[model samples]
Target: MRTPLFLLLAASAALAQTPRPGVNYDEAKVGSDPLPDLKLTTAEEWTQKRRPEILKLFEDNVYGKTPAGIGAPKFEVTATKTDALGGLATRKFIHISLPDRPAWPGMDVMLYTPNNVKAAPCFVGLSFGGNHAVSTEPDVPLSTRWMRESKEKNIVEHHATEATRGTESSRWPLEMILKRGFAVATAYYGDIEPDHADGWKEGLRAAVSKEGANTVWKDGEWGAIGAWAWGLSRIADYLQTDPQVDGRHLAVIGHSRLGKTSLWAGAQDERFGIVISNDSGEGGAALMRRDFGETTAIITKAFPHWFTPTYKSFAGNAAACPVDAHMLIALAAPRPIYIASAGEDHWADQKGEFLSGKFASPVYALFGKKGVGVEEQPAIDTPVGDFVGYHNRTGKHDVTDYDWTQYLNFAARHWAK
Candidate 1:
């Protein structure tokens, strides 16, 4: 498609227009909203009708059930070298290997929990770098995995440095998780897939492409977000078998690119009991039809590898697409889904994201839950309701302790059962 055509279909999403333009975040109308009859009269309906349909919606639109990254990844325990911030005892480290191939080999992961505790609920997140980058808690294991875009060569070769790790700690708030009795599980997203034009040249897509033709990744099989979500399922796979994990309360979480992945993971795999999205913007939580800032065109061009080639066509012509963000949010129906946005981050479309939660509410109501507690967007700090919830933090396009506290509270209200 030509560049102008790309803008014609999706440029409205990434603009910096004042007071927001092109689309209305409130009661915004789009192509069409299928699955509108969501009023659950009985509990049985929630389990059989509402919940399953939501999952199907997510599969068809976003993740499409990407299989977990394959092969026995080279696993290691590196948590012994440090202290868990907030006085919590924990183990942290890196898991290295080109599980499929070494093009984008090496993964650094950090795990925090009460030492040796069994059946603990865990929160999983995707980070930007090697394990050592996540925290200075001497408890945070130094990473050994090969990271591309690095200056030094290691056993894995050309990997990112410990300095590059945990650079986005503002989004993680591990100390908050440690104090809450919840385990924080994280891995560098690049280990699963790189964020570049030809990233598929490395990671699981290349690995899975060799043997599993039936997996269907070609059209839009596994973008960086898809790969990260797939990793969440693998984490779930590992958690299910681990003694310390509760398995029932696994919360797949992410911010920005990772935020988009979190929604896809929670929707595709029921294994993730809760999903939290922070400034997921275009593909994360905002209503695609709203055509707000960071439209389909902007994301596709800026990060071509983020989705499938088929995705680029919808750039400006988003109305032609079968689904919108509401449908994506709906896919996680009945499962507690929390979306956070920053008031100043218009690029992320806080209003649009809130409306998506509002639009998807009817589907949730069908399952006997209030999807969005209110119709009109409320003040930034006012936390409200159950089921689908959204709140604008007093900040920018990042995650903070305030966001974590709300998420933990939301999870506590829903997942604590």
Candidate 2:
């Protein structure tokens, strides 16, 4: 049923692109031929090669023309608490209050750390459910936010809400993170006004009267992804002041659409030490050129608010867009960027994600860092790259322990302290 419509749209899209040839990346543009050697005889050349390339990549791909120039956020810790996880029963919850006023119902960050704190590198993420659902820990703060698809029918009465919390516990293993000396900090993605086009007028942008202020994203403007990514950046700003967190070694991670947010946040904010994109197919780590799974037309038609008004027109005309996933990835050059996918996740384009990583290599090579796994895509379970990483794990779209293992390994290599 839907397949024929997709074919017709794809056919027309291919026809439209036939008239004007786009960026000439057809030839294999690898190695030093296109990128002449910099004067790397001194330390200055190394910094120049590394930092500017990373910055430029962000400029072109991620938050096009946004301020990567803003100063780090000042975190004002308003509260703290602890709880124990299931195994060996050692985990805790620390609630942080962000420093932005009239409060605007500030984000709730629950930090899961090892019982013994020498401070470990954390794999932080934003989840659909609240922190309480991340683990079975009895003490983790019960979420106060409204969950959309919960059995809890009434939020105003608050009687039926007790059972509603901690229902999605299996997906988030906060206890597993703590036992391994890693801290997991998470916030409900919907705390910023349940991710829709219209509801955004009620969140941070409007609630605080911050509408139409001096910023890259304006009032009633930035979509759910941007708002979520912006929230993640604010979380990054909070992490810098924590003694329990090694902020210099933090890894920003997310799954599916949130995976897209992770990549965008990593690209926009340099404070994030590394990035992990799990099944972030289109508008993320997968190349638009491949058009394997999710297409620009589908994303635009369904989720109109996901991108700017300018982005919707490129639905069938994606080839006309100035950027591709590889270019989006180039935005994280020199920094350790990991693009992960599942073998069965056709909606996210497994092979196309691999291609995007491979395509971003020239930019990484500009700084002598390996970008993809190898010349060809490796079999599932094999991880690759010290700088830019890629792996196709066995299973479906959602993230797993296997995916987490690769990200930790990548983090260990980059943040070797």
Candidate that would win on lDDT: 1
lDDT of 2 by residue, 1-417 (tens): 343332443343343223223322222421121221222333345445644654453344333333332333445454454435433333434344334444446677776666576666777789866766665556556677655442332323322155546665555655555666677777877666555445455455444444423334422244557667888877877676777777877888988778888987887777777888988887778776555566677676655555555566566665565566776676676688999988767667777788778877766777667778488887988887767898998987666878777776677677774
**What lDDT does each candidate get?**
0.68, 0.64
- After superposing candidate 1, which stretches have Cα over 4 Å from the reference? 1-87, 92-106, 115-118, 139-159, 162-166, 211-217
Residue range 84-124, candidate 1, lDDT tens digits = 56456556554545455554455666666655456678998
Candidate 1, TM-score vs. the true structure?
A: 0.80
Which RMSD values do the candidates have, in order?
A: 5.6, 7.6
Instruction: After the best TM-score superposition of candidate 1, give how far the Cα of residue 107 lies from its true spot, in angstroms.
Output: 3.3
